[model samples]
Target: MVRSGAGESMRQPVRREERDRGEAAGGGNRSGGLVGWRPRVLEHKVRPADLRAVGEVRRELRQLLSRWREPAGEDLTEIATLLTSELVTNALVHAKGGALVRATVTDRLRVEVRDFAARRPEPRAATADGTSGRGLMLVCSLADAWGVRSHAVGKSVWFELGGGPA
Candidate 1:
C-alpha cells in the first residue's frame, strides 16, 4: 500500500493499464472519502420596502423549507408566508430604515424580520371604517410563537413554526 501526500493509505494500487485507461479517459481518481461535505447555511438580505423583493424572499424561503423534513404540511408554509408578509409590510410602513429578513431551518423553522424602529408593534382594534390593523392578529393566530425584540438601533420581530404536520 502506498501513502498519499496526506499520509493516508491508498485503498488500491493503480496498475499501468488502469493509469493508461484513466489518462485516455482524461480522468484521475481522487483518493479521498467524501471530499466535500460542507454544511449548508442559508442567509439572505433584503429591503422590506420593496414589495417585489419581499415576494421573492417568500418564494425562495418556501422553496428552501419545502425541501426540508418538515412534518407540518401546508399549515407551516401558510403561517410562515403570512407572518413574513405582514412583518415585512409593517416594517416598510412603520419603520424608518429598511428591514432584514432571516430564515433558518433546524428542528423548527424560524423567521425574523429586523427593522430600525424603536417602537414595539401592538395590535389595535380596527374601527368600522378601518381597512387595516389586523396584520399582527393574523400573525398571532398563525404562528406557534411570535414576539418582538427591541435593540438600540432597531427591533427584530420573530416567529417560529414547529416541525411536523399540522
Candidate 2:
C-alpha cells in the first residue's frame, strides 16, 4: 500500500506585504539568504497517456529553474529534470489518468508527480539486457529524499534534491 505520510505540511498563504517585499527584491531574500524567504512554486498538469507532454513539462521545469534568482546549478537541475521525467513517465504509462507535477524551490527543490492511481510503485532489479524498470531505482539512489503520499483520489510520488537559492 502507498504510504500517505511524511512531506505533508500546512503552509500559510503569503501575505500581500510579504509578497510585495519579495517582488521588490526579485522574489528572493533581501540579503540573498533563505531566512524568512518564501519558496517559489511551479505546477503543471499533463493529460492522460500524453507521453509527449513529458518533454514539454521538462522544458517548462528547465525554464523555471533558469528564471530563479539562484538556479539549482547545472548538476542539480539535470538531476531534477531526470527524476521528474521518471516520475511523470511512470504516472502516464502505469496510471489511469493524467499527472499533476508540482515543483517547489527554496534552498532545496522538491518535485511531486500526482496521479489518479492508488497503486504504489515498486523498484525492481533491472537486468543487464533489459531496457526497462530502472526509474524508481534512479529516484531512490539520487534523491536526497523520496516518498509516496496518497491523495483522496490517487497518490503522489515525490523526490527532493538539496541546492537552490543559497
Candidate 3:
C-alpha cells in the first residue's frame, strides 16, 4: 500500500482531504489546491496452481468494488465477478507459473489477469449438455471490452465493464 515514490502508504480512494480548503486536493500524492482526484487501484498476487485461486480472485474483486466512489450495480458486479472467475480460472487451469490480478476503477472498471502462459485464449462453441469450454463466451457476452496483450514474461487477459448510468 506504499506510494510508489514516497515512503507514505496509501489505501483505497487514493486521496487525502484537508480539513481546511487550502491543502485538500493535491496532485500525485502531494498536498496542493486541486479539486478532485481519481485512479483507484487494487492488486493481488496469486498462485495459479492453487485450487483456491479463482474464488480468491472473485473475493478480491468484490473488495475492490466496495471502495469505488460510484459502483455500477449488483448486476454489473455479478457479471464482473463471473468474468474475474473465468479469467483467473483460465490462468490457473491453462497457464504456467503464478498470476497477478489487478482491478482499476475509472470511468470503467478494468480487470486484468496476468500469467506466464503464452497461449492465447480462443473461444470454442459448447454444446447444451457439454459442461465445459464456455469461459470466453461468457466474457465476450458480459464484458463491454476485452483483449489479450503479450509481454516478455507473460500475457495479460483484460476486460472492462463500463460504469455508466445504471
Candidate 4:
C-alpha cells in the first residue's frame, strides 16, 4: 500500500473488480463519479532506467484499449500510447528510478506515471533540429487534460484523453 500526502493508503495494481467497487486509486473516492459507473484500472511497473519497459507498457495499454467492450478506436489507442510513452520515458530517464504506471478508464482514459522524484516536469523549448525534449509538448497538445500531482514520496505525471470508452 502507498500512503498519500493526505494520509490515506492506496493499494497498488487495482484489479477490475476492485475498481468496479469504486475504490479509491489515490486516496479518494472516484470524485463524485456516477453511481454504478465504475472505472476500469490497469497498472504496470517499470524498473529503474528500463527504457525497454516503455514499449512493454505501451503494448499492454494497446491490449487493454483493444479489449474494451466499447470500441475506443485506433486513434485513441495511439494517442494514449504515445502520451504514456512520454511520461514513462521521462520518469525512467529523469528520475533514474522505478516508476508505477496506472491507467483508469471511465468516460475518458487517464494514465499516470509516478516516480520517486520530487521535481516536476516542465515543457521545454525544443529546437527544430532537436530529436528530443518534446514529450510534454506532445502531451500538452494531444491530451484533453494533463497535470502533475504531488505524492508523499514523489509525483505522478498524468494525462487524459476524452471520448474514450465509458
**Which one wins on TM-score?**
4
Tens digits of lDDT, candidate 1, 12-102: 7554335537855976432223355321234556664676767877787778777764344786787788888888888888986788888
* Per-model CA lDDT versus the true structure: 0.72, 0.83, 0.77, 0.84
Q: Kindly list the per-residue Cα lDDT of model 2 for residues 135-160, writing each as its tens digit.
A: 99999989987888888989999887
Candidate 4's error at 166, in angstroms?
A: 14
Candidate 2's C-alpha runs over 4 A off are: 1-37, 163-166
- The TM-score values for the models, in the order shown, are 0.68, 0.75, 0.73, 0.75
Candidate 1: RMSD over Cα atoms? 16.3
- Candidate 3: list runs displaced more than 4 Å: 1-36, 164-166
User: Quick one: ranking by lDDT, best first?
Assistant: 4, 2, 3, 1
Q: List ranges where model 4 is wrong by over 4 Å.
A: 1-38, 164-166
Ranking by TM-score: 4, 2, 3, 1
Range of the 10 consecutive residues with the lowest summed lDDT in candidate 3 = 14-23
Clashing pairs for predicted structure model 2, backbone only: none
What are the per-residue Cα lDDT tens digits for candidate 4 across 1-166?
8998888998787543445456554544543555566668889989998889999999999988876656788888999999999999989988967999999876678899999999999999799999778999999889987888899999999888866322
Better of 1 and 2 by lDDT: 2
Best by the lDDT measure: 4
Candidate 1 accuracy as lDDT: 0.72
lDDT agreement of model 2 with the native: 0.83
